[model samples]
Target: MKIRSRRFKHALASLSCAATLLLAPLASSIALAADPEKEELKLGFIKLTDMAPLAIAYEKGFFEDEGLYVSLEAQANWKVLLDRVITGELDGAHMLAGQPLGATIGFGTKADVVTAFSMDLNGNAITVSNAVWAEMKKHVPMANGKPVHPIKADALKPVIDQYKAKGKPFNLGMVFPVSTHNYELRYWLAAGGINPGYYAPAKGDITGTLSADALLSVTPPPQMPATMEAGTIHGYSVGEPWNQAAVFKGIGVPVVTDYEIWKNNPEKVLGVSKAWAEANPETHKRLVKALIRAAMWLDENDNANRAEAVEILARPEYVGADAKVIANSMTGTFEYEKGDKRAVPDFNVFFRHNATYPYYSDAIWYLTQMRRWGQIGEAKPDSWYFETAKKVYLPEIYQSAASELVAEGKAKAADFPAATEEGFRAPSSDFIDGLTYDGRQPNAYIEQFSIGLKADSKL
Candidate 1:
């Protein structure tokens, strides 16, 4: 009986050992399952503080957290960056929100580009050259020796008229034809009763000023201040540091910010080729995870890390602008006219308010703008807008990363859109002109705009 009992005990111990072995592989599989795809990645960006999330993700090891070895490169211009992404030279890029939409729609280049992340909100401002600002200030309203916030272009209308009467064009610069700077500049100018003009690509007039009061041209971000200083352009609309650079060099005065034009506006996005995304879905999700973490770090605690972000952007590899220049708008205050500083806490929002999610509504808005201004010549059905937005903004891929973050307790459900979400935002009326925009009814929205081409309207 004693021998039989000892044999029974040994069998029980063996069963326990077997159970431990079974559970060990399960845990190992769970851990190994979390590893990233395509461990090495190269990303591109223009020299704007809006690209800080990419720099911060790399610098703070967020990419490493996802097992991604990322190399962030600053390209010469937006065109080069977009081309590189199309050709696989860049895995992804910090791009204009319109860039992916434009590329997918074959505005400049034919490529299937997608954005799962929006890099930032409201990092652009319009600045006028010192000479033009001097003339504009004479017409602007002042109280307590300060120009009122959101100094409208009404003040500059007469200056443009002077140029018009003199038979010389009133030239201004924006980064790209489909850029936020282009649209925002146009919006502000149109709102203040300035004719920013139209694009007739079909007519071979890509200059975008068929009949104009102000001839808006495309100048790359880094060239804005230098172009203004050389008197080549009277004013420009651009993202970060460059606007403040105008103030530092005494070349120009920033008249209004996009935040003032449209509060908390979506700006740049992280774009990748459709081929890259399809071939390496896991790598794409991992990249989104790293960026989302970096964006959170940037906006956490009411932007406690903004100082560090400004420093990172000032480094030669990122924005490469003067630290003081970058700090002007990056650290919660923006310098407009020389020494005229104001508190703008949300000037460079990165993560909060669902800023990282690539909303289909945001994509549709850019497309609507393109259609409104003759970039898209003919009227497209509302379904076309929805289809185009879905093509460019991949909410499915974004949700994958968001789900992983929630499961790991890294982020909360409240931080993103609800688990069951419709791609479109509930009709946004937040534009500068207070025009209600229902992405579902894009043609109606385009028709309501006071300026540019509308439904059945051609350049």
Candidate 2:
């Protein structure tokens, strides 16, 4: 309804634009291209602050600028969101970075899902209950009467061992089996010599607790605080608002952020079925363009707009968390322990560091984690990794959309990766364990992980 009223106002203004356009020839030449194949779209998202791109695009009229009227619906959970996208119940949805790759590879629900846009980076943290934190705090190194930053999983390892000694399951919650939260949590735990466990899908054991020292299960993001409070789980790995929710509730303390786990790690993406993309290529590119604009707005001027963006995300139609909770991390700062707020401007990065680029390296990293954890039961060549990443992460589509924006002078050419980019990021040793990852060499990267399945290893 708001979009309709906005369109009506635009129509009224267009009647007076002819005279102005005649005086400004450059503006007339900069007009948008043909309308999208599908003008009306319903998109889906989970209730997380990282979904800010979709909310901003809708609220700021970016979608309408591309001649698209969009509806944003919050899904019940990740699985339902992915299923709806596959079934075309929604045009596209905000998805975990691994969802498209996982679906394409037949990990859970086999389908040809693809993404042309990455939504954001580094918006997750691992939090522990006050009880767990109390025990873990004894192991953590302290400076200035507070736990040192980037509290390694080694501190939590002793607490997990104690729980095992008592014969109690040390369960943790991630949003989904193939979620970035699952892999990031596993990575942090394994880096500390704790086995977060393996998935034996080949033997029909999809639960990833086969050899885990800590059992991990899926709990929806909104329910993480309540679940940890109920003692059903000791801690959780999740996106913002929820992690901050735990601190506000005073039931838990965030131990480490994903930015500390692996700096600027890819988090979420805009996913659609291959069928929908092929059928509406123009519409797909237009959608990516609008989302790109939204992301730029979110991170521009050193995040000057983040406060207003937080207010929009706090609305009932979006993330719906209290504005204070969303602002805790969204406003360029993260509160770990109570009264321990620290500056982490990149914690919820939307566009900076080329955050919106759908890099094949990012996709291959997820595949490497899946293989390392045994969800990918067998090993594959590096070539397979590259090919699979290309199939799912369509950087060409993203580049096409970005080029349009640059041509329109809405974004600078330097804001995106070069056209000659081969889709892999440069090698980096940014993990908590300081392991180097070269996306071009997936098997080598997988072999470097001591706790996971090594090269050619079978479950």
Candidate 3:
């Protein structure tokens, strides 16, 4: 009644083999779903430590893991970098937080630039030439033989007034018109009752000093020290190595960092043209994921990796300055006067304190500053500010990339903004003057400050 044992065993083995073949494609489909659309990419950056994320991402193979090949190149300046991205000569770039907004609004160059990734936070300082610092030191308050921290612009205002009364222009340098340095410098000067001038687009004057007390102008970041040394500018606001270079050369003293002006302020961003982003959405998301990983690496272990990062930044193509000079600020310490080094752990934050998130509040703050200085030229309704911020900051893109990382088990949910995030941060009153800023009520916030042109005010 029984069949042959060999034939029965053969049939059972054949069925099991078929089942294994059927399930193989299911697993393969899961793997293939995670691969990036485009594998090769080109990104641009300036010679600054904040660009460490791009370097780290490329060196650490984070991009490779995402099936992306990336090349990091240093641009001559912010303008050239932004221009390349706009013209599609580069895929994206390490950008000034304002670059994307400024470009989108037709400030300097007209393009639809967008950013989902903020590169870092609080990596800039305002440095004054030694001669200027010596003159202002008399007005600064001394505590325990050291000038008080967050040295107010009040001290510098008197020095500038002296220059003005003597018929000399009080010139200062910022890297760009819409740069954080320009806004921060203007904010500090305005807080101290110094009019930093205005930008009159209607009058064909973007010089930003239409009846001003201090005439502000643009100087490339690396050239800040030389510009000041040549007497072309008396002071400057720029990202590090340049500021620290001045101190090492016995040329200047850094009065304050952007952190003191606006705590944990957003600095640079990963900028790309809106057209490029749309055409290569998958590639853009993969790029963001890799950058987020690099940012976490930069800030991981409380910046234990900064010394190594400074070394990488010191190479010729990168910052190209002495490691010691870059380390002065990169390693959680900053020197004020010669030999006055102090701990400022957040001076160069890359990822912590929500540094990677491109908050709508941050964009609105810059917009308010523009309006304050007559850059906007007229009263904009609160809706216009919010809409403009939304146009430039692509939170939706950030979410897509973060979700992909989570799905791949490469990142955790806690590492990113919550699903319930409203894009805007809570109202903050952490300014140097203790004034409150609410992104939703920008005009009201602008009116709270003692200085700056308000709604409907022109130069």
Candidate 4:
């Protein structure tokens, strides 16, 4: 889809959507300016391109429209961000999808963090250092002069074997213990028969490299390229603009994106403490309302505002990467090596495919990953997955925001999920391993994996 002038105007229409929504009947649009439990808010985020929704809501005046003044802060790391939100220092944050689930399940710092809005989908990639890529390139199939992509981890297995044969360990980095990056890296390596290791949190084993081919650990997102260049880790799985930063710096090549692993996979979300959400229900709903408008602006008319969005994200306070680096993935194309650019329009999906809506299947998938890698440490009934998803993912709040947007003519009913949606996506086999997953029957889905524990299997 081309970025056109008319669509740019459409993208900016959300500016007026807020003002128009204010004039709506008192019976309509649920936001009451007089009734917010709180107005001024502080939100936290790490410096990644997928944080655009929070940035957009603030910069575009969407928050002000809801009678809310928002202050967006960049946190040092995922743990700090989650801790701040949990401690009431920050009202909410851009969080990994697994953060809420991991918190609720007592995987890490146990707090009842919950998300009403899913921020974006598929903004991550697994990148290998130049030396590793040089060795792996020999095993990758080539088309013309470029290596065929959606590169399987099979290409890296030989390189790992060479490292092992030399009595050196091959290490990789993910952002956090329960991050989607860790799971995606594990999934890719396991699909190639390389054990990315496992966790046994029950036994106080969270190093995640108990029985491993490539030992995986945590490195903050901004530091990934530096860490790889310093020879600390061979590769990393992380969100943009870190992945694109590696390509631009000529230090590493992104082997495969998460999109290639699972098509339209859910990624980040806006998480707040469950206690905070319960105390300020109206404020939470209004915040989600502003974010939904921002998402719609982002994806309207095929991402027509993306260039403008890139410019905004490049500002010092937001993602703060070079605009060119951020645009590598933001503008509908992703560069693998220096010049091997290919169209991946959905690489940084903000709203398309109903990306903002929280789904039960999305939560269950993360829960399954935790169980598969032995983080959960025990088998549970399928009903537990469903109930956990309900507690963490607040689809009802999203519906309130969406309905308000519709009532005020700010969004069309057709543009949102059906009111009757049961909160599950149709079962999909869109994984790199070619296995289907049905959220309703998590045990059955777990059984389909060739590697990793089945429902009853333990570490």
**In model 4, what lDDT does residue 75 have?**
94
Angstrom error at residue 254, model 4: 0.6
Instruction: Pick the winner on TM-score between candidates 1 and 2.
Output: 2
In candidate 3, what are the lDDT values of residues 336-383, reduced to their tens digit?
999999999999998888898889999999998888887787788899
Writing each residue's lDDT as its tens digit, candidate 1 over 58-123 gives 888778778677777789999999999999999999999999999888887878999888888999
Compared with the true structure, all predictions reach lDDT values of 0.87, 0.93, 0.87, 0.91
Q: Candidate 2 lDDT, tens digit per residue, 1-459? A: 124535644685777767676657676666557667887788999999999999899888888888787878889999999999999999999999999999999999999999999999999999999999999999999999988988999999989999999999999999999899999999999999999999999999999999999999999999999999999999999999999999999999999999999999999999999999999999999999999999999999999999999899998888888999999999989998999999999999999998999999999999999999998998899989999999999999999999999998999999999999888889999888999999999998888888999969998
In model 4, the Cα lDDT at residue 340 comes to: 90
> Worst lDDT window (10 residues) for model 4?
1-10
lDDT of 2: 0.93
Top-scoring candidate (lDDT): 2
- The residue pairs in collision within model 1 are none
Better of 1 and 4 by lDDT: 4
Error of 3 at 57 (Å): 0.7
Kindly provide the TM-score of model 1 when superposed on the true structure, using C-alpha atoms. 0.93
Give Cα distance to truth, residue 413, candidate 1, Å: 1.5
Give the count of colliding residue pairs in each prediction: 0, 0, 0, 0
